[model samples]
Target: MATYTINVNGKKREVDADPDTPLLWVLRDHLGLVGTKYGCGVASCGACTIHLDGSAVRSCSVPVGAIENQKITSIEGLSEKGDHPVQLAWKEHDVPQCGYCQAGQIMSASALLKKNANPTDDEIMGAMAGNICRCGTYNRINAAIKTAVKNS
Candidate 1:
């Protein structure tokens, strides 16, 4: 087993496991941070989205050892009281259908908002293009993002 030190959700963590282990498993299994879900292990679904060094990344495709010393932030770290503007907007706009994909969707939206506080509809769609919501909440998601931008 290889040892890797990673910063997750603003805390330092030391884990011993195979280097090839996906960061998703490491976070869910070792660290007990289960906010990042496992949808498509192949990185196609964006369900395991997380911020790796401030960029949204598919945790399922990231090797644990590859992110040594890199800052990682999961949905849990998005807000202490689950009140980040995006989260609030999500609630305000009622963006979830089944809610399985909301976490990843929120992560992706948060990343986009970080870069562009006031994104156009096309920009919002572009930023969230990779994340697939099986519940077909795309319209609501876009509205929520716009609401977040306006509220922010």
Candidate 2:
């Protein structure tokens, strides 16, 4: 087993496991941070998306060792009281259908808003393309993003 030191949700965390273990497992199984879900083991599904150094990344394919010293932010870290603009907008727009992919969707949306405070509809779609919402809440997701942008 290898020991890895990483910064998660603004706190230093250390875990002992195989270096090649996917970060999603480490975050959920080891660290008890179940906010990041596992839909597909591969990177095709964005259910495991998280922020690595403020960039959206698929945690399912990310090795535990790869994020050493990197700032990792999960859905839980998005806001202190779950009152981030994106979260609020999501609530106001009722974006979640099944709610399985909302965490990843929110992560990607937050990243996009961080980069482009005023993103066009096309830009929102492009940034969120990788994240799949099986509940088919795309319309509400887009509206939530736009609402978040307006409030931000």
lDDT tens per residue, model 1, 64-119:
97886789999999999999999999999888888888899999999999989888
For each candidate, what TM-score against the reference?
0.97, 0.98
In candidate 1, which residue pairs get closer than 3 Å at backbone N, Cα or C atoms, i.e. clash? Answer: none
Against the true structure, candidate 2 reaches a TM-score of 0.98
> CA RMSD for every model?
0.8, 0.7
Point out the worst 10-residue segment of candidate 1 by lDDT. 93-102
- What lDDT does each candidate get? 0.91, 0.93
Model 2, 52-149: lDDT tens digits are: 99999999999997776789999989999999999999999999888989999999999999999999989998999999989899999999999999
Which residue pairs show backbone clashes in model 2? none
